[model samples]
Every structure is written in structure tokens, then in C-alpha cells.
Target: MKNEEKTKKRKAKRKLSTGLYKLAFFYAVLLLIIGFTLGVVYDSFISKGMEDEINKIIELSTTSEILYASGEEFCTIFPRTMKEIEEQTWKLGVMIDELESKNRIGEDLKLKYFDLQVRDFFLVKKASKECRINPLIIMYFYTNNLVECEECYEQGFELAIARNSLLEKVPIKIYAFEGKTSHSVVNYFKEKYNISSYPSLVFIYLEDGEERWLKEEGLINSNQILEKALTFQNASS
Candidate 1:
């Protein structure tokens, strides 16, 4: 019976090993399912928040009459609102980048995002003019490396530094557009401004109560152009 006992013990050990492997596999599958659920939940939460922020901006833009009526009060309210809007816009940009990288964002959504951004720009520009503010617009057109956009980021950075040095008195607005945007706004801007290059930097200033584009001659030396513009503006006013 010793032999029989040895066989029974061996069978029991094999059964225990199989049971342990099954348990480990079950736990592994459970962990994978849990992780996947959490990721979905997190993504949903972020998307909802992003949608809410975008909607608020749209609502604000749509009711621009309220903004126009602010008069002096508009300037008081503008800085804070602009900061919030810019922050949200930056976040939206990050989201767009991520979605685009994954090939998940659709053309419709991309166009809508660009539309909202452009709408905000016009609203801010109009508000600045009504408030008698000299607004500077620096536009960056990046094509996600699909095409060569030489020095776009560099120019944007240099302009940003210049803008920051101005001490926030001037309403300097910076906007970035994916040149490959599946929207008409890109074409509209290009046609209106005679923009031909990918990394083209356009500086817009208010002149004689109308929007005017700064000359190309002024652009080659970026900082000098801005300084001269500032000096001329200061002397003019």
C-alpha cells in the first residue's frame, strides 16, 4: 500500500499545481479587465470636462453683446476671462494633438475645434478695439511635421518673449493653427493675408482705426520690427 500512497500523493500534488496555475490566470485576467475599465472611465471623465469648457467658451462668444456692453468694465473683466480661455484653448490643443497622434479625432471635430478657436480670436479682437486697446496678434501655422514648417515654433517663442516683456498692458494674442486643418478658415486667412509659407509669422496691429498687417521688410529682424512698431506707436499716440 506504500506504492499506492505514493501515487495518490503525486496525483494530489499535480492537482494542486494545476489549481494554482488556474488561480493565477484568473487573477491576471481580472487585473487586465479592471485596468481597462479604469482607463475608459478616466478618458470619459477628461472628455466630459473638455467638452464642458469648450461649451462655456462658445456660450461666452455667442453672447458677445454682453461683452460689448461692458465698456470700461469689459477691460476689467477681459484679462481674467482671457487667461481662462487661453488655458482651456491650450488644453484643447493638447487633446487635439493626442487624438491626432492616435488617428482618433475626426475631420468634423477638428474643424469644429478650429472654428471655436478662430471665433474666440475675433471676439477678443473686437473686444480689444471697442475697449480702445491696441491688440497685437501673432499667428503660428504648424503642420505636425507632415510638411516642413521651418522655424514656426522658434518664431512663436521669440514673439511670446516679446509679448511677455510688454507687461500685459497691450492685449497680445497668440494663435496656432494646424495648416492641414480641414477647414476653410485656414484658406480664408491665407487668401486674406497673402500667406504662402508654412512657418509664416503674421503680425497684425491696429492702424488708423482698422486692422493692418505689418510689412514683410519689418519681419526679417523679428525683435527689431516689434520694437520699432512699439516706438512708432508710442510716438504716434
Candidate 2:
């Protein structure tokens, strides 16, 4: 009877050990599966993030390429004389007015014309002093929550004329901003001067590091725009 009892106890002990081993094995497999699943999820998330960043980079590169290409084209076909620029400006205005009347200027077309005006009318002018006041009269086309086009042809028509009227004026540099890539520069100016408009003009003097902002209300008239530019110029000087 004693031997039988011992045999029974030994069998029970062996069974308990085997059961514990099986349980541990099952849990190990479960833990491995869970880890693998988590790894897959994390990898997918990382890959998607990387892809989004790459797409943004590509879009910015394309925008810059378009601007550069457009500038080159403008330089190639630009008129050699101020008289020719004036003639082209008049023609462009007529076309733009007609387009606006007919609602034919799509967003893309507006952006293109805006860039064209900047390159042809503003940058192409050789006379630095004559171009001084032109910087104050920028035409901005807002798109994608940013300024897509900036030309002195439409919105700054009078300002351009005023700047051209003055002789021996100080040279002013105009910086064009487009797309989200230009947001940094725009925000910098806006923050610096507390600007609150899309096409706001800020006259900057590098000599004294002074900046004057022209608000949206003042930009309604060409004369007012020119006055603001002149004021900024005088203050900076």
C-alpha cells in the first residue's frame, strides 16, 4: 500500500510539471505574436510618415523649378526698352480686364500672369533708380493660403507710375513669395511688423534695419500705396 501511494504521488508530480511546461510554452508563443504585430504597426506608421515628408519636398522642388523656368522664359522674351515694357503692360492689363470680365482667368492662369508681370515689368528694368518705388507696388494673388503671384502690373499700377516719376531715387529690392515654401519669409515679415493682410507691403531699409508696413485698407488706391512707399523710404533714409 505504501509503494502504491508513492507511485501515485510521483505520477501526480510528473503531470503537474508537464502542465506547467505547456502553459509557459503557450505564453511564450503568445508574447512573440503580440511583439510581431506591434512591430508591423510601428513600421507602417514610420513608412507613411517618411512618404509624406518626401512628397512635400517634391512639391516644393517642383514649385521652385516652375518659378525659375518662368523667370528664364521671361528674360528670354522680355523687351529691351522701357517703351516696349510699357506697351506690353498696357496689353496685359487689357487682357487681364477682359479675362476678369469673362471670368476666364483660372487660378493657374492668374498665378502664371502674376509671375510674368513680376519678371517682365519689375525685374527686367535695368535702371535701378527708376525701379526704386516699384517695390512698393506689388500685385499679389493669393492661393493655397499663401501669396501665389506678386506683380506690380495690376494692383500697384499707380504706385509703379509714381515710382517711375521720381528721378535719382534710392534702389529698392523686391522679394517675391509663392507657395508654402514662402511662408517662412512672409511670416517673418508679418511677425516683425505685425501685418495682418495677404498682400501687405512692407518697405524695408537695410541701412537702418527699419521696416514700415502698409495695411490692406491703405492699399485700395494706387496713390495711397505710393505715399506709403515714399513715407517708408523717407523714414528709412
* C-alpha lDDT of all candidate models, in order: 0.65, 0.45
How well does model 2 score by local distance difference test? 0.45
lDDT of 1 by residue, 4-66 (tens): 988887884333578889999999999999998997777667666666777787776665647
Expressed as tens digits, the lDDT of each residue in 154-206 for candidate 2 is 54454446546432354333333322323444445446556544444544432
* Cα displacement (Å) at residue 136, model 1: 1.0
Which residue pairs collide, candidate 2?
139-151
- Positional deviation of 222 in candidate 1, in angstroms? 8.1
Lowest lDDT 10-residue stretch of candidate 1:
213-222
Candidate topping TM-score: 1
